[model samples]
Target: MTRMIFVNLPVTDLGASMAFYQALGFENNPTFTDETAACMVWSETISVMLLTHDKWRTFTSRPIPPATSSEVMLAISCESREAVDDMNEAAAANGGTADINPLQDLGFMYNRNLADPDGHVWEAMWMDMAAMPTDT
Candidate 1:
């Protein structure tokens, strides 16, 4: 069986977080969603658990850091450069803020950063498989 990845993030508002992710084209998995949390499926292998701050604390002993003070960033890859732009645009329209950095256009790779309503940073990227290195 393939191992799937689940990224749990603490959000100030679950509904708002859900809306933000939905705007970026993710679908919610209602089977695992509830009032305290929502299961957002980005792909077959990638899923994000959006949990309320209080609810999130139940799984961790450490105090939840203020969004402005957090340093961690999540990076998600896309299949094309257009997808990267689309995600960034969606984020901006859905209460999230786009990164201040200039757009990266490296021919084979493109990336843009965005911060959700609670200030969680996410990097939307696209890598060209044609430019990937192959082992002989």
Candidate 2:
């Protein structure tokens, strides 16, 4: 069986959250979408489930954290540095805050962070393994 990961997130507005994710290259999986939740697919093995506060409560009793608090930051790999830049630009243009963290460029690797409207942080990175530094 193929292993898969589903990241579940609690959102205040389901529709707006869906749109925010869609803007970041994730496609809506209608099979798992409904009024209170949406399944956004990033790749074959990865998906994000956006659930409304009420729907989220049904799964857990934990209190929802404020948008300023972060439990985790998700990261995705890009094909190149340009791709990373493009993703950041797209995020900024689509209601997300771009470059939330200091941009990093280590020659072999480049990274930028962005936050969704709901303040979920995501890192867009590109790395060139061949150019990675080696211990002398």
Best candidate (score: TM-score)? 2
Q: What value of lDDT does candidate 1 attain over all alpha carbons?
A: 0.89
lDDT of 2 by residue, 45-124 (tens): 99999999999999999998888988899999888899899889989998889999999999999999999888889999
Count of backbone clashes, every candidate in sequence: 0, 0
Q: Which ranges of candidate 2 are over 4 A from the true structure? A: none
Error of 2 at 83 (Å): 1.5
lDDT of 2: 0.92
Clashing pairs in 1: none
lDDT tens readout by residue for model 1, 7-121: 8988998999999999998899999899999999999999999999888989997877776765777889988888899999999999998864577878778899898888888
Error of 1 at 24 (Å): 0.8
